[model samples]
Target: MDSLEQTMADAQARLEAAVADRHAAMHSPVVGTPDGDMRVMVLRAVGQGLAGLRFHTDARSPKVATVALHGRASVLAYDPVARVQLRLSGPARIERDGPVADAAWDAAAPFSRRCYLAEHGPGAPLPAPGSALPADLLARRPSLAETEAGRAAFAVLLVEPETLDWLRLDAQGGQRARFVRLGDVWSGGWVAP
Candidate 1:
């Protein structure tokens, strides 16, 4: 709050906290692809200096293909109680097989992994509204071995932020800052809210 550096640090802290704290307001941020599609995704991980953000997804999801083709993404998160918002965009990629994806999949709970066990990808049409999970899985969580079938459909979406717009609202007015990354370094300054 006293300096630009502090503001940037606050952004980093909020992002990192969002990943670890499920109840955090920013825990589920809106992820957008170049195809103009957006959805709320759980925040899985945040890298140092806001370098890379990790999210889990189903490889068969439409966003996976869009991200693979465009190699770009945007994420927006807001904390109503804190009156802060973070808008970030940059290069991104979907990895179905890699250390990152593997680790993410391994870290997921059985219930979480059950999502990828669906016979079809997200948004699949059905006769009636349903989760698309196997009939048995609908009633109970899958065991570790049962989740193996979902591994092939699991993926990690990694977003390396190149720009971050951080804003905070207050009674006095508001404060805003924009940061751009160049290689490993980041340069930023205050901006009008």
Candidate 2:
């Protein structure tokens, strides 16, 4: 056991802890959407470090432009078993085309792709309430052309996490951890939970 080996072991522990923290955060009830609405789930995406988070919405969705204009948003997650909660805030960007979009489009499942092909965006008028897909279309799934159209309509949100608040619950007491990013550097500290 060398000093370098010890250091590497400690770093690995921290990374594992961070992932556990993220998983616990996802299961908590405190997760929130940008609209101040509480019913939405926050999905983290691939990028550099905690560089991206994704939320699916119609191209015409007001939230699409809202996030673009504000460039900042927040997420809250709570866990009962761990008695932990996490809150994250960061700047956001929209990726509409190019490799990023193509990759995400490729990852989407067929059912999800159908939403993209629909003519309406979020909250658009419905065709009566119980209307079925046209008979011919129902018999066959949407073709690649239709799927492509929907993929084009998708707007991928890339959020670059700037700060994170990690809260842990304890029977006797609690704890808090905060991380802030400056340039490429990440500085973190523990506080009262």
Candidate 3:
């Protein structure tokens, strides 16, 4: 292959490796939660672009309304292998019952849709134990028609990352880097560890 092709392949590999490393780090047990707890599933990354890290929640969820009102949120992703942690801050917006919501709904499995159909709201009270599904719904699992009713309840949270602080720990020394977006441009630089 040509030199340019080799260089492009290497760059693509590096970008994929970075994303995979970040994803693995986020699944680590030592990750921190917004409530100051250490939890593995603290954050859910959603959305569709490099600038977007999306999360899905019920429209009635407090966090849903919070981000809707505030338009900002944060996420922490840690990589155990590289001993790196990424702290991301961004502006958030809610997309409900639109193309984005429809797309997200279509991507969900029927079982997940059933949960939404069963719940009234994000933190609504649950049915008594042993409660049974309606006979018709029981004879057959929830169909696409049954799940459609819950589509309005789902909300897509779009977060446009504004800044990312990458911190790494190493034996010789530590490393820190910060990336900030300004208009259409993204600029980054190393900082003191």
Candidate 4:
């Protein structure tokens, strides 16, 4: 709040906290693609100094293809209680097979992994509106072996932020700062709210 350095630090701190705590308001942030589509996605991981962010997705999903073509994205997270809004924009990539994707898939719970096992990718049409998961899987978690089929559809969306805008609102007024990343270094300054 006192300086741009502190503002940057606070933004990173909030993002890190969101990764560790699912209950955090920013845990599920809005991700926007070049196609003007946006969806709320879980915050899977965050790298040191806010270098990168990780999110899980279905490889067959439309967003994956959109991101692959555009190679860019925007993420927005707002915590009503804290009255903070964080907006991030940067280059993005999708990985279906990699150390990061493998580790994220492995770390997922059976129930969570079961999501990738859906009979069809997201937004698939059905004879009748219903869950995409198989009827049998609806009752219980799939075995580890069963989840293997989903690995092909599982993917990790990595966003390396090139810019970050942080805003804090209060009764008095508001504080705002903008940061731009060049290589491993960040330069930023306070801006009008």
Per-model lDDT: 0.93, 0.59, 0.59, 0.92
Q: Candidate 2: which pairs clash?
A: 28-78, 175-193
**Order of the predicted models by TM-score, top scorer first:** 1, 4, 2, 3
Question: In candidate 1, which residue ranges exceed 4 Å CA deviation?
Answer: none
lDDT of 1 by residue, 1-193 (tens): 8887898799899999999899999999999999999999998999888988999999988999999999999999999999999999999999999788888888889999999999989877988887889888899989999999999999999999999999999998999999999998888999999
Per-candidate TM equals 0.98, 0.71, 0.69, 0.98
User: Candidate 4: which stretches are off by over 4 Å?
Assistant: none
lDDT of 4 by residue, 101-193 (tens): 999999988788999988899988888988999899998989988888899899999999999999999987998889999999989988889
For model 3, which pairs clash?
Answer: 25-79, 46-54, 47-54
Candidate 3 — number of clashing residue pairs? Answer: 3
Better of 2 and 3 by TM-score: 2
Across 1-193, the per-residue lDDT of candidate 2 in tens digits comes to 1332342233324333543455633532233336664445435343344556565555676667777776766766555565656566788767777787778788776766776766666666776873233444555577666677677678776666777676666766866667787875657776666
